[model samples]
Target chain A: MKAIVPIKRVVDPYAKVKPTADGAGLDSGGAKFEINPFDEIAVEEAVRQKEAGRFTEVVVVSVGKGECEEQLRKALAIGADRAVLLETQEPLDSPAVAKVLSEFVAAEAPHVVLMGKQATDDDNNQAGQMLAAILDWPQATFAAKTDFAADKATVVRETDSGEETLELPYPCLVTTDLRLNEPRYIALPGIIKARSKPLEKRPLASVPAPKSSVVSFAPAPARPPGRKVGSVAELAQAIKDRGVF
Target chain B: MSLLVICFDPSELSQVAGFGASFGTYDVLLLTGEAGNAGASKIHVANLVEVPPADNIGKSVASVAANYTHVAAVSSMRAKDLMARVAGINQSAMITDVVKVFSETEFERPMVAGSVLARVKAESTPIVMTFRPAGFDKTVPGPNGSVESISISDTGRVKRVSTSARQGGRPDLSQAKFVVSGGRPLKDAATFEQVIGGFADKFGAAVGATRAAVDSGIAPNDLQVGQTGKVVAPDLYIAAGISGSTQHMAGIKDSKLIVAINKDGDAPIFDQADLGIVGDLYEVLPELEKALS
Candidate 1:
């Protein structure tokens, strides 16, 4: 069996991001980049499954510009046996991205695909579901836990109501949620070894144009500054003043 | 032009109605297992399709795609997940967690964990989107509109095995007008329930917790409030023991009134709260509870 993981490079979650002065995009200058946290978890899960002798290989795939190769290498260091970069400079919407991935999945025929539920950059949360739709495959999204058997996988999903478990046949897709796993940190030796791992690069294949575009971005409106009351009594009075008591 | 609003929970009909109102005049496609009135020109699909456990509701909606110029649902996880796939199958454009609906093709939504807002235009037909429940007021129930029933074959392949729902009598965090949330400082589950849960019950509020608290097992995952969890815009939001991570702040930024109670005065939540009390919650909570009683 083979497990494929799709990873994305996003602005570091810890760093502050601002809208570009032109309001067309983010002011990414000087911002640090990292493998999207959830995708890191995906790579970790795939690696764990491989370590358990459940798979022969764990392949990490990324779609982006040259910088994305850096993230692919990082995924290798984290435990993926190989990495593939769909090098592209074009801005691809979620559907376009899904189209590219679905094509790749069809050719690769991996037994299972694991990816982050959403990328922090766009927060679209569409790619996994879109890929499932395109591939006509079962998908267990927002997956917190996955119990695998020989022919089926049971995924515990984190839903709005609570946890819902779904059983799907093999050759399925699962999107990682926050609680899935804590990604292991890459050590110096792992980083050094990652440089020697197989990293394949291929140009992005042509796909349909994206139908949606970002027209403008604006800073979120500021919240009114808070006032510190001396005691609980004052806090109660404030709540009462707001007619909320 | 008509609008199709996929119904998940019956209570979500009002949010769908608010979304449909923006289209001037539209029809609602209510999809559910049971039938009910939704105060709109409606088509009820009781078991329109046999939904496989692993299949999304979007597949069924997309299969029946018809004359509607817009398709919408409340921005819950299930709805957003389904609508996104529907958009993919239709090769249409979709925007999620929309806060403003200017037209069938234009909308505004938050990004960067709600720190930035983007106004987007979908230059495609049959726009599919999900509206943030907090962004619009629930429409008042009107005279019953016409309801028609239709059925379709189920193509779902996934099977649901089990569900472990969080047991509670409190109001849903998303629908509640008042909320009381806890953070890491709450310590353990017993204290979380006794303190935060106690306060929520006292004020007739919903219970919420920061991701930190939920991750630590002090609260159930469903009670989490943040960019990754549930976004709430209640009338009153009280943050106790929470330090207010940016993602956590993203969920409550829209609350009409915010109160923070924490021992450390420098917690970021204090800056966002309308009123803040810098003291031990162990002391403050009981005092406030007594005062309210």
Candidate 2:
């Protein structure tokens, strides 16, 4: 089985995001950039399938500017067999990203596609599910555990209360939760070896684009800091007192 | 106004998609937060009514049971409310988190900490189902839109009680610009404070810790930066000793510039770093601090 793990290049989480000049977007001046954290877990899950000997190849894919090729290469270092760069210099919406990813997925026809529950930048976790809709397949999101076998995968998603399990045939989409597994780091020697691994770059023109228009781009409103009680008991009491759990 | 909406179990797993798929048809309204932030389509409705859990249908029915066009909500945790709405009753309604309501059909929702997915396909035309949180294509707005509140509340159940709120401290280390994050490489809590405190003070940045560093029982979860903890989008993110697991990556994906300082140059953090120093963080930090000074 082959896998495609979608990733994003967003402002590093450690950077302080000030409101953009118009109070609509995040200020990006002199901020750090990194792969969406959830994407990292997706990449790890795909790699684990290979290590478990369940699959043969894993490809980490990203859609962004030319710089994303470097990000793709980093995924390669982590054990992804190959990488695809959907070259787009400007930031893209979920539909746009899904469109290009669907085009690539159709061409590749990988048995499974894995993605982070949501990208950290926008916190919109629908890209994987949206791509699944475009592809017309089953989707298991926020998966805590995924067991892949011959042409089929059984996944368990951890819920706030407990868990939900689903058994679906292959060619499905799965978005992973943070607790899925502690993603392993690539060794120094592995990094040197990864330099020799294969990396593929594709342009936006090469694939069809979504028939959509971005009406605006803005940062999410600042959540006035949530209050913090002394302890969980206090937190619980506060929740009770407010009657707004 | 030309609009068609659905309500479903706000806590059902399919809420997001059901809402997303139906969003293009008309003006979409999502109910969220205290639940998930449900209706966030770029071109949809946004009237987050402060209601009780799974009481939307009950409230909507009791308030406007006569205006029975359609109502949509979930049937997972709020199964009782859905029953009351479809039970052919009017005046007597219980408060519910009704996601959407069109006609007869209903939807349900299931959510983890924050991710929302809903299950739709309850009935036919005049569909009433709840809009699942994060269910639709949200980053992209549809067309020009506006918000109009339909004050459909009369049989209010819960009354406003006294509120006790506290002022929060700084946004954690992940949210800090010049974060001084520590990993297992820091031997103990005391050593950690020695290094992290100076860095935090020097740069006026917040302090953060890796899971490994936190497990030493030194720091708290508030300072832990990883997948399960706070997601930080800082200006300059630094990895002192963190190996950069995807779990840890959850907290720092939005940083602008990442600087990795570790004994292993091959750590996953380096891949995300703009500048990776290939030396011991113990040796590298003070030297870098001296240079910054």
Candidate 3:
């Protein structure tokens, strides 16, 4: 069995992202980029599954400009057998990205496609589900725990209500949540080994262009500064004064 | 001319109807399993795509959405999952967690963990969206809307094997009026259940936890309240032992009134709390609970 993990490059979660002066998108200049935290978990899950003998290969894929190769290399270093980059400089929306992934999935027919629940940059949280829709395949989003059978995978998802477990047939898609697993760090030896691993690059022109466009962007509203109360009694009194209780 | 509001759970109809109401002078179509009373203009009872396998739900919705100018639903995990796929099938411009609706074509939503707001304009014909229920006013049940039964074919692919919900009497964290959240200081699951859970029960508040606490296994993943977890905006929020990381603060920033109790006076949560009590939670929590009781 083979697992395909789709990874994304996003502004580091710890860094502050500022809107561009033109208000069209984020300011990319001098900003640090890293593998999306959730996608790292996806890669880690695939690697763990491979180590457990559930998979013979774990292939990591990314869609973006040339800079994305750095992220794919990091995935390779993290134990992915190979890396694929669909080199596209143009920004693609979630639907367009899903379309390209569906095409790839149809051609590759991996046993399972794993990816993050959402990217921190766009925060769309749609790609994996969209991919499932395009393929008419089963999807389990926000997976916290997973178990595999001969031809089925049981996933426990973290939802607004509670944990929901679902059994899906193979050749499905699963999106990883933050709690899925702690991603393992790459050591110096792994980094050196990744240098010799296969990294395939495909032209973006092979995929469909994005249908939706971002017209503008702006900063969020700021909350008012709050003052500290002296004691719990004062806090209760303030709540009473404000008629909140 | 018409707005289709897909209803997965009957209980969420009012919220979905409320979101649909934002499109003034539009018809509301409730697509659900069992046809019940709603405030919408019309109701469609469909059974073929009633449960999980979000793909089937998306297809069912897409079939009806083709006739409407706008499509909306309550931004629950289920709805977002299904509608996102519907958006992909229709190739429509879609947005989720929309906080405000300016019109049928324009809306506002938070981005980058609520630090930036983006006003979006949907150029597509049937603009698809999922509105955060907390962001909208609850819709009052008006004259019983018209009901129509629609047939749907099952795309049997995904199956729900089992569900293990947290056995708790507390209200759901996202929809609770009051939320009592804990942080890393809770130490262990036992302490978290004893202190945080105990206090939450006393106040009839839902239990929430910081990412740190959840990561430490002091709380379950669903109880995590942060940018990466559940975004909650309860009327009253109490923070115990939390130092309020930016991501955590982002989730609860919309809370009507915030009360923070922490040993560290300089905790970032204090800066956002409407009332801050600098003290050890071990002592303060029990004392507060005693006083309230």
Candidate 4:
């Protein structure tokens, strides 16, 4: 069995996200970049499965500019056997991201494809499910618990009342949720070893680009300070009185 | 929904309010399947959709869609079978999950996330775009667009296989009453165990989480309450190390009472907390549990 994990380079969550001058996107300048934390969990989960001998090879794929290769290396250091970087410089939104990913996954033909539920930079959280749809495969979102056995996955999901489980066949797409597991850190030795492992770079010439471009992309405006009341009970009363409740 | 936007987090709804009200041109009604931390708003009177006691994703959407004429239903860009099922319901779907809008006569939604967008002319009045929902000027207080009852049809586009018999596992943290949340300050799981464990045990609360913790693999996504995850209105929401992010706040905005137990005085959780304990969860939680006991 094989597992493929898709990762993205996103704005580091710790940094303050200021709006771009144009108000269309995040001004990531001078901010640090990191492997999308949610995607790290997906990578970790796949690597764990491989380490347990529950699966065979692990392929780490990153879709972004060449900078994403560094993210792939982090996956490699964590435990991925190899890396593939889909090269492009443009800001590819969620649907476009999924389209490129679907094309790549089809060629790899792994038993399962996993990704973070959503990339923090974009926060759209739609690509994984869209990829599943494009592949005409089963998809699961917000999975709290997942077990792999007999080439099938049993995933516990969120509902309004309580948790429910879904049994999906292999070759489906799954996005990892935050509660799934804690990711392992890369030891210094593993980072050194990751360099020796193969890292493949592919151009978007073969990758599909969405025909439409963003008419606009803007940052969300800051909310006014909630009339900072002295106490929570007072806050609740204010909210109720203001009729925002 | 008359016009839908996928809101996994409560702050996303606020963002929607900002987008719709500030940049929007239409008098649209915002309907959240569940209103997040902000709680119920008179501006957007959100309604809860009923699902069959045991059903797959298809049945859940179908049951909800049955209640309306459903000119179009917006789903998350990641909703695999949302449009296919809507098509199966015999509603001509202009399916795109990317950022999209209404073009007066036609509804334009992004076909592939935010890649290339497509325009679907609504030969039928209510056209559905799965991903991008149009921004509203403001949440108008009015009737539910006079939604009439409708029945499911056999469109035969594609059908999802049912997995109800086996009852696969999925977490419903969105519904939990007591959530023990963590943040960047929590450092590692070993340290978090004492604080979160004590809080969960004392209040009998399920753990709540933020996107920051969830992404780091310290917390599971289902346990995360934010704009992109589940929205929980628990009885007691306790924040151990969380610094309230606007996005993360959406999930727990509906929580009945929020307690911030942190070492930092400036943590955003204090701004919204009913009870702000400006101290360490490491010190406060054990003491809190002991006091309760």
Candidate 5:
């Protein structure tokens, strides 16, 4: 069996980024970049599955410009067997990205596809579900815990109200959540070994037109400055003044 | 344009209806309970099991996709997941967590965790999206609308084994008008609950916690309020002990009024708060609770 994990290159989650001066998109110049935090969890889970001998090969794939290969290599250092970069200069929406991934998955035919629930960049939270729909496969998203068996997987999902458990047969998709697993640190030896791993780059065979496009960007409006109160009684008075019980 | 609002949680009904009103007269697909107050021209009821998996719900919604020019739902994890499938099935444009609807085709949504807001345009028909409930007001209830029963078969491959929903009558974190959130300083679950939950219970406010608190196991996963957790925009939000990480602030930036109480006078939360109290929560919260009583 083989597991496919798709990763993305996004601005570091901890770094504070802003929109470009022209209101076009993110001003990522000189900004720190990393594998999207959630996708990192997905990569870690797939590598663990491979280590456990459930899958012989774990491949990490990404769709973006050539710079994306850097993130793909980092995934290799973390234990993925190989990497594939679907090179594209065109901006792709969640639906278009799903279309690209579906075409690749058809030829790869992995038993299971693991993905991050959403990227910290766009935060669309759509690709995995859209891919599952396009592939006509079962999906268990926001999975906090997943147990793999011969033919099916039991997953505990983090929902708004609480947690839910779902079972899906093979050839299914599972999107990782925050509590899934902590990614292992890439050490010197792992980084050195990653250099020898095969990093394949292929031009996107077909890039579907984006259904939705960003028109402009603006910095979020700031909240009015607040005043500090002296004590609890003063705070209570303010709350009462606002009509809050 | 015919808009079809997907109604699930009753608390978010008016918000969704109010948003749909911007697009003109709309109908509803009632998934769970009554939406008599939705103020829609028509309510299409779907016969299904309780809390059906989003995969099944998405398939059901897509089956009737041809009837409306647009489909929308209140933004939530489940609704976003379901709408993605519907978008895929119909090849429609999909947008999530829309904070502003400029028109039927244009919208503004936050990116990079609310630091930047991007205006987007849907270039195609049958647009599928979810609007943030906090960004809009609840629409007033109108005369009862006609109801039509619709058959939606379960065509999903996933099966639900069990669900352990959070207990108690606390209002939902997203819909609550008043919220009290705690931070990591609370230590353990018992202490966190006694302090934060106790304060919230005093005035029937919903309880929330920063990601730091949740990661430390002092709070349940559902109570997390941050970029990756639940986004809340209550009328009044009280923060005790939280330093207000950027992600945490992103979740609460929409809140109408914010009050922060932290011993660290330099905590970032105070910068965004409408009222700041520099003091120890241990001493201040108890006194504030007493004052509220």
Candidate 6:
């Protein structure tokens, strides 16, 4: 069995971002780029599953410009067997990205597709579900723990209510959550070995145009500065003043 | 344009109804539980008493989504999952965590956490979206809408083994009018609940925790309030012992009034706070609880 993981390149999670002057999109504020933190967790989970002998091979896939190959290589260093990059310059929204991934999944026919629940950039939390829908496959999202049998996978998902356990048959999709596992730091030797891994780059196949686009972006409204109170009674009065008490 | 508002949580029906009513005459797909007066023209309910897994319900929604120009739900983990599938099956446009609706084709949502609000336009039909209920007004209870039974097939491919529901009866963190959250300084689970939770009980405010607190196992994952956790916009947010990481700030930026209580007066949280108290939360929270009482 083979497991496929799709990762995304995003602004570093810790970086502060702002709207560009024209208000069309965000400025990364000179923040470094990295594999989206959630996607990295997905990569780590897929690699761990391979190590456990549940799958014979693990392949990391990414979509976008050539720069994405850097992230793909990082996934390789983290223990993915190989990497595939569908190079494209056209900006894609969730629907279009899902369409592209569904096509790839159909062709690859991996038993399981693992990915992040959401990308920190858009934070749409949709691709895996959308891909499952297009593929007509079952999906378990926000997965905190996953146990795979020969033909099925039981996943514990982190939901708003609490944990929910779902059992899904083979050829399914599971989106990783933060608590799934702690990703290992890539050592110098691992990085050196990544250079030798097969990094395949192919032209992005034709897909439908994005159905939705960002029209403009504006900075979030700022909160008024606050004053410090001297005592607990004063704090209680402040809370009372807000009508919250 | 006609709208079909999907709701799985009966408790949020009024908020969902209020949002849908803003777009015009709307119908509802009540997936589970009981709903009170929601003001929807039609309340289409499924057979189940409890909400089914997302994939099962998603197929049911996709099967019927084409009948309306807009399909929406109050944003939640499960709803977002199902709606994405609906969007995929229909090959339609979708926007999640939407904060504003300009028309059937236009909407506003936050990205990069809540630091930026992006106005988005849907160039396709049956715009599938999830609205942040916190940003909208709850509709006043009206007469119960007409009910219609909707058939939902259990795909059986995905089986729900169980659900460990969170401690109930407290207002949901996302919908609470006031929130009291703590960070790692609160320490272990017992102390977290006793201090932060105790203080919150004074005002009926929901208790929240920073990711560090959740990661350290001091708090439950559901109580995590940050970029990757639950977003809150309460009228008053008291953040205790939190230095305010950027991700945590992103989640609470929408809050109406922020108050920070920490020993470190220069903590980043104070930069965003509307009021602050530079003191130990262990000492301050107990005193504040007493004062509020």
Please give the distance, in angstroms, between residue A195's alpha carbon in candidate 5 and its true position after superposition.
1.1
Q: Report the lDDT tens digits of candidate 3 across residue range B98-195.
A: 88887767788877777777877776666778878777777775654577777655566677767777756999777788899999999999999999
Instruction: List, residue by residue over A137-179, the lDDT tens digit for candidate 5.
Output: 8888998998878889899999989999999888989999988
lDDT of 5 by residue, B1-293 (tens): 88998877555556766687688788888776655677888878774557578776666679787688899888888887788888888888998888888998999898888888999999898899888867765667574378888776676678999999885889999889999999999989999989999889888999999988887789998999978899998989999999999899989998888999999999998889999899999999999888988
> What lDDT score belongs to each candidate, Candidate 1 first?
0.82, 0.55, 0.81, 0.57, 0.87, 0.86
Candidate 6 local lDDT, A1-245, one digit each (tens): 89999999999877888999999778987888999988899999988988999888999999899999889989999999999999899989888888898888899999999999999988888888889999989999999999988978999999987899999998999999888998999977888889999999999766578899999999988778779999888998987898755
TM-score of chain A of 3: 0.95
Candidates sorted on TM-score, descending:
5, 6, 1, 3, 4, 2
TM-score of chain A of each: 0.97, 0.83, 0.95, 0.87, 0.96, 0.97
Best by lDDT: 5
Clashing pairs in 3: A220-B116
Poorly placed runs, candidate 3 (over 4 Å)? B25-37, B47-50
TM-scores, one per candidate: 0.96, 0.49, 0.94, 0.63, 0.97, 0.97
RMSD of each: 1.8, 16.5, 2.2, 9.1, 1.4, 1.5
Fraction of native Cα-Cα interface contacts (under 8 Å, chains A and B) also present in model 5: 0.84
Model 1, runs deviating above 4 Å: B33-37, B47-57
lDDT of 2 by residue, A7-119 (tens): 88777755545445653344656877777778988888888889999979998889878887766777888889988787866555555577678888999999999998776
Q: By TM-score, how accurate is candidate 4?
A: 0.63
DockQ of each: 0.81, 0.02, 0.64, 0.13, 0.84, 0.83
- Per-residue alpha-carbon lDDT of candidate 4 for residues B1-293, written as tens digits (9 for 90 to 100): 34333333333444344333322222222233444432112223234242221113444444454443332323432233344333333333333443334553343432111222234344443333443223333243222222222222223222233322211232235445567788766676565555675457565567666777756756544455765655566666777788887677745655666767678788877777766666666766666665544
Compose the digit string of candidate 1's lDDT tens values, residues B51-113. 344364556678665457777778778876677778777877778788988766778999888
Model 5's alpha-carbon lDDT is: 0.87
Give the best candidate by DockQ. Answer: 5
